[model samples]
Target: MSTPDTLAFRFFSLHVVRTRRLGPSLVRVTFAGDDLAHFHSGGRDQSLSLFIPAEGRTEPGVPVEEGENWWQAWREQPDGVRAVMRSYTLRALRREPDEIDIDFVLHGVGPDAAVPAGPASRWAARAKAGDRVQLIGPAVTDNRAIRFRPPEGTDLVLMWGDETALPALLACVEALPAGTPVRAWVEVSDAGDVQQVSTPADAEVTWLVRDESCAEGSPMALGAIKQAELPPAAKPYVWIAGESGCVKTLRRHFVGERGIERRQVTFVGYWRRGLTEEQLRELPED
Candidate 1:
């Protein structure tokens, strides 16, 4: 494997090597490639954009070009031949043999309580060894999308995430300095969807399982937030993700109702209520 420069984004071709069923709604796909030895992930909440070939397709045609506007070149490809591109968090990375893991939430229920076999979900749920894909990610350790920065003097860490952000949030907890104080509220679809997360910090995690009667986004989510008695901290660093509208509502509540400063919170809208990832990308940031 060739080592790329320390400050660059590059495409690496990887192949599925294993798969695991983590819970009722989560599937983990592990991939490996010789080139992954060059991949640099900053650990917590690090994200990668994967170009996955449609099922039964073998090759993921990543352009040989490297440098500025690589995305423009990718966009110019014909729709029929283009791969499905989506952003996902790196669940784990191992370099001894060059491997990485990605956890996909199997959402979009079908009639009769079935799981929808969408592009990414289908691939992950049925992924087999030798399945190939292209990953565009940091070749360096300090990429800009690694949104775990908390300002100095921060004494507490507060996090709220739906299933989509669970891997990232857990990664953060796994790496936090021992004895740091942390509080997290994670929402999932059902009791079976709850995942075990451990941290060395003085940590408290509350899991909220959504039932069929629960409305999408902020209605029930806001009610749950209001009902919890939050730990008091002089300086709390709040991180929120999941549904776009829900994230926006929580952002306002933290700053307006909770009396926290706008700068003290870090938030990202991972997805929306009714839009696909591509459609969500086209919208202005909330």
Candidate 2:
């Protein structure tokens, strides 16, 4: 029952049929619809743009009648558009008859927060068996590749992120080569924000928590990383993502100061403090 439009671009129409709490601040929403059949199955660290329709609206925030020209329709919409689009990593993709599951990391309350009790989170929280919405982007191809394919003989993998980047972290852990040496540093708002992550037996995972006033950038994870002794193997791959400032600091330290080769590390500014996703998107390339 899927339409050609669904496969044409990374966008699709979806209906939320189930929801679950993965942790205090994280929620996983499972969506299904005929359009899901066209979903691209690119794994770990892959991100897609979700276009959530406004409340009480039956049609998508952007018209699907544009077929492959949906983005044009979105730009040309009269009342502008009643939708909120957020960038989210595709944590996992499972193929079924006509559906897919997209897990979203729900950040807490605030105007700058991507889903702060906004239409996307609200709909996901209350979504029943029949609720429908529109999804867009992953946008076919951005300059950055969706999945990372490490070079042969990669001895170790180092990954670091805050909760905002957890979906990508989870996907990376799940897809890494079996028994690959891994060191992970994850920062969370509070101790309770930590969630159990499954990684290969050889992987070493560390959870860093910030106190009430500290939040994520309290230098906890960065300090730990500074003190950590990396395996003495040449050409270990590093993947870092989180707040822009924090990530930029690490990038400066690792790639800028330490002289690590750029290709050996992937640093992403997943989000930034005080900036909306749109603002973050508008930032110049580093």
Candidate 3:
């Protein structure tokens, strides 16, 4: 079970069946499992935790039968043998054949450069068919992790994200109702990181290409947002995800500067600069 309220989070064994490069920094990994038929994902920006083994190890050593104690057992494992877990968004989910697609950002070479590769990016870069990993995800739709909740009667949507949050932002954009108005700002490492996204919403996307110096947390996007002219809408739903510091800054801009009600926006720090997810997760709640 997950924290606060158990929301059908379960452990499942998944294997890589195919891999492809979507753009300069994005690698799409498709996974299939026998238990996928039992899995239910509420598609828009749905996320799950993946346990990837360290170098030279093939299987992720995470408990599959511990239920509510699953995470505790995994955390208690020897650091050397424990799999490095990371959270990622679902790019695509096909129910017919029990398959799911996750797009990972390659920060070192393909789409990102001037830095070293992280565990997840390294795995995606070298991953091949038959590579297996453990996952703790949902078997039902109403999980606590799905945060793209736009309230009823929303008139427009405003979104902001960086490379790490691109997949989730794009997924949410594509799933919006037809004729809905959406204004999105997506920041990537470079022009090569840009990809075409199809959506039925009256969507307007402004891609912010970043130079190496500002690849992680630059104020470029926020600067652009300040100068942007948003379409007319009163009940605007806003979603922001990416580096923690940037997410917080953007949240303040929306609420304090733009005068949008703080409650109208849903923001998440998918990761943080100069810190690992584990460190970010350990931060005490305010």
Candidate 4:
């Protein structure tokens, strides 16, 4: 929220243009606004802090000034009057109409859901055209929020992610250069969440669907990667994200067990099991 004078990031007021169901558990929300003309991103796992209206509110409450102290002002507001903020990835951006797409994983929205849906999921589930929101996103063509960086001299790209990270994983894949070799594993709660990825890169994507046999919040990535055969590459870059516990396990597998250099791998904990987003933020990173 307190950006440097370069102001690589800034706030944008946007409204939902449409919503499309990608699968039983995923929805793509497209947003457009006059302010998008100033938004810029290098793509590939770009992060955004979205502020949605609080429950029963028609629009989000944002800071009055777009200054370095905007975060302080927003945080000082009464809890009931402040907007609910959540982190999400940019799925796609189009220039013709100045629109951007964000994919939301609708966790716990079904009748038999074991856990109740969170505010962001609930909001995204019912999002309709003209619904207003504000987001803090990149204003520079290249910024730090985009984390899927494969360093120079990398021979192969490896990735693993769960439903919560699918949007980012897909964006990274779509941005790879032509003929780049990539191996990716995506785990989803249901087979319906599997998607078609189009990319110029030579990417091999494997979808792992959890059924009744797989335990909730348990990771399948470690075992799957252990048994699989990876294409030999001297310098391989790895990216893993999803639940915090699973991400740590996979990071260990790649760095500690597989002997991949720690610096060559990027891991993000999108969420932690049994913890609310605010609760997760309060805890120190492991």
lDDT of 1 by residue, 99-171 (tens): 9999998875335554455688766777899999988778888887688877788888988888899889888
lDDT string, candidate 4, 1-286, tens digits: 3443347888899999999999999999999999999999986799888999988998898784757776777788887778898889898889988999999999889898878998899999999999999998889988888888899999999999999899999989988999999999999888998999999999999999866466645456677888879889999999998888888888889999889999999999888877888787678655
* Per-structure clash totals for the candidates: 0, 0, 2, 0
Give me the displacement of residue 176 in model 4, in angstroms. Answer: 1.2
Cα deviation at 197, candidate 1, in Å, is: 1.4
- As for candidate 3, its clashing pairs are 24-111, 25-111
**Model 4 residue 168 CA deviation in Å:** 1.0
Residue 233 displacement in candidate 3 (angstroms): 1.2
RMSD of each: 3.4, 4.5, 2.1, 1.8
Q: After superposition, how far is residue 71 of candidate 1 from its true place, in Å?
A: 2.5
Local accuracy of candidate 2 as per-residue lDDT tens digits, 1-286: 1222343355577877777777666777777777665566555777667777666765557666767666656656655355656767776667655545566555554455434564556656555666667766343433243645566888888888888788788778877767888888988765666777676537888998765466556487778888998887787888888788888888777787656778888887767888877566667766
Per-residue lDDT tens digits for candidate 3, residues 225-251, read 999888777798899999888899999
What does the lDDT come to for candidate 3? 0.85
Q: In model 2, how many backbone clashes occur? A: 0
Best by lDDT: 4
Which portions of model 3 show Cα errors greater than 4 Å? Answer: 1-7, 110-112, 214-216
Q: List the residue pairs that clash in candidate 2.
A: none
- Scanning candidate 1 in windows of ten residues, the lowest lDDT window is 1-10
Index of the highest-TM-score prediction: 4
